[model samples]
Target chain A: EKSSNIENYFRESRLEEFLKLTKVTNSYGIFTAHHLNDHIETFLMKITRGSGLQGMEGIKEFIELNGLKIYRPLIQIPKHILLKFCYKNNILPNYDYTNNSNAYSRNRIRNNIIPEFEKINPNFLESINRITKIISQINNKEKIRLFNEFEKLEPNYEENNISFSRIIFNDLPEFDKKLILKNNSEKLSSGTFMENKHLDYIIEKSYSKSNNFSLDLPGPIKLIATKKRITIEKLFEIDFQ
Target chain B: EKSSNIENYFRESRLEEFLKLTKVTNSYGIFTAHHLNDHIETFLMKITRGSGLQGMEGIKEFIELNGLKIYRPLIQIPKHILLKFCYKNNILPNYDYTNNSNAYSRNRIRNNIIPEFEKINPNFLESINRITKIISQINNKEKIRLFNEFEKLEPNYEENNISFSRIIFNDLPEFDKKLILKNNSEKLSSGTFMENKHLDYIIEKSYSKSNNFSLDLPGPIKLIATKKRITIEKLFEIDFQ
Candidate 1:
């Protein structure tokens, strides 16, 4: 129901799509034709933008959207092959001129970046997919590990907020601390933009004696810390989906 | 001193230049004219080729090479800016034809890919530098943290290798396990290409009930597991240098 040619606005629209699709569709997924080039571009984008393991994971084949699913079967298929298939079958497809044009970040990545990457290693895209597949398997196990670890942390929750003591958090491993911060902030934004810098800052402050401070994070959420606890909540009353 | 016309081989040669320069230089430093673009290319290469946090940390202004140092004072300056200065000052520089050719991976990335990334995010290069700066700071702390953590691991040793028991290794966090493996393997290769995949393999096998297996890893290192311990050693005696 929404589209944005601009890169900055694209994420905003995508975040809200889960909610929109919930109203219109049955439990079945809304299928997309996003192919290999798109996935490769995403990998490149995450790298260029300085993302972590999650960012490197690229796009998922299936994403749970409320009760519905967003499925992309052609994600692993190369765009050239898809074009070849269309051409061989004598099917005329509408060309998106914007893709050919260098308007969007993703378009620029696909058109300009990936070809150069291909020249480096022809199998580069597939290699990234290989890592993605392995990491996804590891993450499946890690997801369960995180929830179980979170139980040890003993978080307290109100209707709109969750808080954890800094005492135990400061002593945890760096990744576990990151997982706890990410988990605490996940529900604050559907856009999923809470970044490492924000989490790092809060984690840093938690160790210091500074009693009270609130940091405005990327989800546009607020992470407020008092003498003993840290809490994250949405600053605005907007539902994602 | 070995120099690579193509950036791909350049980094490979750069890795081992430490030992090579140890033989030649009189303990001062070797300087190069690598500007900001080259640094950016290395960052891009590391990302496309699937690197971890250290890869994103990019080039250091100074690198310790035995008694000598590899220095790049002009690393912060962009190529075009250097060219502009050269033009304004009437400085004659030798023209390199290979840069115009699409034969090298780094050249292709620099000449083709970067300009396209510029179209997407004008601040993209600077943004990466900013991350590099921040990560470098954290990595400094992390380096100390790793050593401190390693001390607690209390590794055992024999004639050929340092060994950690699976019972204790399996109990450690995933990243701690990775740090342990990496710390142990750092002596194996000065090239620094032992990736997460290789480490993950050894870590995975360390926990499994099955023992007495040897895993051949990238960097040509072997992770040999006995009933009680896991050992990582250079699979071959071939010096990459």
Candidate 2:
């Protein structure tokens, strides 16, 4: 009965939407405590969903949402380790009981999938640790480099505040094309962005066509491409809703 | 049998000899791939044994042999994630089936403990992920800050490398004090540093006692504290055997 109420709330309003409605953005950032197993489950989910590096980039310890920063300090730890830590510190947190249920996808992973996997290979955790470390280092450097390049090309609009032009971004490296689109789209007042595929559609169309084309981005940012230039504009006015 | 034979060969010669014979040095770093599960298992084993962080710290990925720059990239990852990753990537690594048997403390965790854990709390993985992330970030920043301060005080051998005078390090903040001992001790030509407590003992002696007192270190880093000055020298030429 209690679980039904929880399920009802989920059906009525998506978790993401609910968070957005209540989210009070401040200097510190939106924070979450996601541990290692959660990360693994998420990684698997994204992979199953066929998400690329951006989706699989793990949970962001710090993310910028409509100029509000989000942070997750616990992304690097695993579940069992955290519990041990709590025990060592003599801090016992409330434990949840539904994890063993096969109904939830993540719970299924915890019970059936991973245990079966551990049975097949004892060093399973070790291998994931290696891959994630490598990915983090490489991705972090790449993000920094791309962000730096982006800052150079994207004009800062002090007067309009959230507005930026995409004309300059067109001149950057092809690899960065996706980065610019994602950033610019996220920058919009809607607080959403054109996906990788959507951005790709725009980019692909830009080369073949000459007319001005507008993309109704998921976020506040809009994209208009013409033969002469590609422009990214913020449709929203203020930082907050 | 083949795997056991290979493991035994490595255990007897490669592992044992490496552990016993390798001189701890500053010139190179020793690294290990300790995963998140490994750390938790360690904490579990220690708790079951009625121990503390001495064993628990090894639960997380850390620079264990400091002079050797021993790194554990895989320490932050859980076993299930690694297995899923391996499955997705078709890595097909060898499996160690001993984890299924609860003969050892960690194996008990692998078999009985964690499963019961998921039963009570489905979000156990998520909670762990959050805690580990916090620890990793804190540890990472702490290392950087300690290294930066230490780097400032120590004589620059290269942009990254530096030499710390024993006397100067004695005056550092407690935060930087242990780090200096850890870092400088690790960097010596012979690998190893005295225990943290012993390093503290040496530091106390440097300030209180005459300037020219020699303390026995665990590794090749020599500590000669005298009233006139303190000296930390690489004593790899001395016999470790």
Candidate 3:
């Protein structure tokens, strides 16, 4: 019941949907055991796709998505350690079939990329965790705190579209700029949605006198900068909201 | 002529030696072709080893190091493009024997980790380049400018030591605080010196009324904070300097 149809086929939104669906019957949000492997793969994927600093920061320990709080408690513990724990407790771990196959880019990264990274530096995973922790520390400090304060502005990410108030987002600092533009804008093909420059261009354009201008991103993502709203949508997605 | 004994063994200070040795009869600074692949590999290695934002910015187009300008003009051009350019221009590129074998951690990253990244995103090189360019743009703007101003404090990275002004660094904005603490302070065994937590801890300690307090980093790197200075040095480096 936790694995919904949307999550089974795709990665992004289904987790929140599943959590919300579960919340109807259960109490609080869904707590998960998304281990270090998951976090590391996400990190690998982020850099590969040319993600900005915010995107490269793997996963939050607690994420409020779609009004549902999804908590990942075992984010720091590695898969091997968990397996060892299971062994010590005399409990057999379930081998998820999905994890074994290369059905998704994530699986490929987990099965292939991380191993190669391991070969380069035996403590590579630990190093990534240290960096992740450091980035988390930074986020916890002044910049992220200030950025979070500006969350009063309601930014919406619908099915195939992303929209936020143009005037509100324009004059903010770069950290806030990157935060809002991070996941809210993305292209369907290749990796990385819009880079810092792309996001900066869009933000800069939103303030200009031209009321009707659209910027084309790689892989059919179009950012339409109307007078009041800056919207990002997939050009190929026929049912875009 | 290219791979000097200094460069063959060392990664940091030796580059200056190689340049100086080469500049015996040369007119000005030594320019080399450090292609995009090299840059990308370095970047991957940097973040994997808990590098800060400054460290993750792989190679500089023009770096003035140790009274010498080491210029890498083809840094923006990808390896494949350079290879194609070589083929079209009828120029035979010299094969660096070091790059061929996985004798070094960097070689392993270049030969192993990057290929896996490529598999995840075919245009991963372009993505890295895009991110690097974006970072360059950000650096061009503000954070980097402020950080560069702080560069007047000559932070030395000796065999077992790294030292800069404790008083000046303590009162900096977070960006400058982050920059100085990055490469200038690192564990002697690993890639990255200090994480954000370590920096924050040091910065926090610097302001305290205590005259002499010492904080130990990961393993051996000790940040000794005195009345007038904060010094970082490996615990085991025999020579005190």
Candidate achieving higher DockQ, 2 or 3: 3
Writing each residue's lDDT as its tens digit, candidate 1 over A175-215 gives 78887788667554444466767778877888888999888
Instruction: State candidate 3's TM-score.
Output: 0.69
lDDT of 3 at B231: 73
- Candidate 2 residue lDDT tens string, B1-241: 3343333333334333344444533234446655667766564343333231233233544443322335677776787788899899999867556344334546656676556556546545444444334335445656687777766564545322334565576678764676566656555532352454776787677667564677656544566664654556654333212
Residue-level lDDT tens digits of model 2 in A1-241: 3343334333324334535654644234455667767766665444333344454455655665544455768877777888898999999777655333223666665676556546544544544444445346546766797778766754554422333344565566665777666755544433353555786787777655457787765544566665555666765432321
Ranking by TM-score: 3, 1, 2
For lDDT, candidate 1 versus 2, the one ahead is 1
| lDDT head-to-head 2 vs 3, winner | 3
**lDDT of model 3 at position A137:** 62
- Native contact recovery (fnat) for each candidate is 0.38, 0.00, 0.65
Show pairs that collide, candidate 1: none
TM-scores for all predictions: 0.62, 0.41, 0.69
CAPRI tier of model 2: incorrect
Q: What's the iRMSD of model 1? A: 3.3
DockQ order of candidates, top first = 3, 1, 2
Ranking by lDDT: 1, 3, 2
* Candidate 1 residue spans exceeding 4 A from truth: A1-31, A50-53, A65-68, A85-103, A131-153, A166-183, A192-220, A224-228, A235-241, B1-36, B49-103, B130-241
Which segments of model 2 are wrong by more than 4 Å?
A1-31, A67-69, A83-104, A151-173, A187-196, A219-221, A226-229, A233-241, B1-241
